[model samples]
Target: MSDVPPIWYEFRDAVYCGEFQVAEKMLRETPSLLHMANGIGETALHFLAVEDDQRGVDWLRTKGFNIDTKNEFGTPVLFEVAQLGYKELCAWFIENGADLTAQDRDGRDIGEYLLYYDKSEMADWVRKLGA
Candidate 1:
């Protein structure tokens, strides 16, 4: 929010548009962009998760970014994407070290959200994982 760099917007636009190659090129030139958060502390990982780009997520993780990076509200990238009902992604996150028990400032964990949004199967799955 504070005078974000023009390239950051370009980078975000590329990612949002599903142009991972272009986004990767931009990041290659501006490596710090990987860790740069927006006004609310959301990073490129958040966008990639929303896009369901597992490869992109893995790429970011290989670059040393925490997959559990939280936004200002304490919502992790995995939690944000769980609402979309991507069961495979949910499984991958849990298998790859995502914290299923992570909660937001509202005291809501992934299971609470999955159940709230009628994702009973996902809720049940995460519940089994100790969410």
Candidate 2:
């Protein structure tokens, strides 16, 4: 078993719960754990995607986390936000220089994948971002 620190688990849970302040504290105290993922290969950003917390996303970006980082299943931050139809978050991510053309494990581009998943609005948003 890998000897991951307790703060790593706390950070993941905090992220999933949208507790940005706690997550930030944990991250600041243990910067090395910022890149750690949870049981499903979800990094802090993946949890933030579900939380849809723009503030947390901005904080993470400021902390130097890679916006385009993918989980083990190859799902990028944009993919998750798009799937959830979070237009503002998706637009923010695009403005911050996320790769619009990145593909997932199935080799589907972000736009195509969103449409395939019946997220037409998000697919349209992706198109608007020039994906």
Candidate 3:
């Protein structure tokens, strides 16, 4: 009998299974689900990051979801996509108000984190956004 919220699991599954349509419908129907996090504070955005589904991410943005929220570990959603090297996603995050200067609990800033891992393409894109 897992006591985790069903919506959170459903939201995560929708992203994991690449069902953006379902996710979109649910979010539109229940906006607060956007703020629903599990025991670890991971929302549907985190699942999107894990899936690397650009469309799902874009849908979330179109719905006015804030991508800058920090996770349970104090890491912003930017950190989730940092290693993926999705140039478009990274750029979109910056354009949509994601904080490049956000530091995680480990004290690593997002731009630095991108460069430290040699994600030059993404690093270059972020650098153009200024310090």
TM-score of each: 0.77, 0.83, 0.74
Give the top-scoring candidate (TM-score).
Answer: 2
Compared with the true structure, what per-residue lDDT tens digits does model 2 show for residues 32-123? 76687766666676677667888777777887778898887888878988898888888898899999879998999998898888888778
C-alpha lDDT (0 to 100) for residue 54 of candidate 3: 67
Worst 10 residues of 3 by lDDT: 122-131
User: RMSD of candidate 3 to the true fold?
Assistant: 2.9
Report the lDDT of model 1 for residue 61: 74
- lDDT string for model 1 (1-131, tens) is 47667787787777667687898788889999978877778787776777787776766777667888888777778777778877677677888899876887778888887777788887787778666
Residue 64, candidate 1: alpha-carbon lDDT: 66
What's model 2's overall lDDT?
0.79
Residues 39-122, model 3: lDDT tens digits: 778777766765677677777667766788777888787776766866677667777778767888889887677777887677
2 or 3, which is superior by TM-score? 2
RMSD of 2: 2.7
Q: How close is candidate 3 to the true structure, as a TM-score?
A: 0.74
Task: Show model 1 residue runs off by greater than 4 Å.
Answer: 12-29
- At residue 119, give the lDDT of candidate 3: 77
Steric clashes per prediction: 0, 0, 0
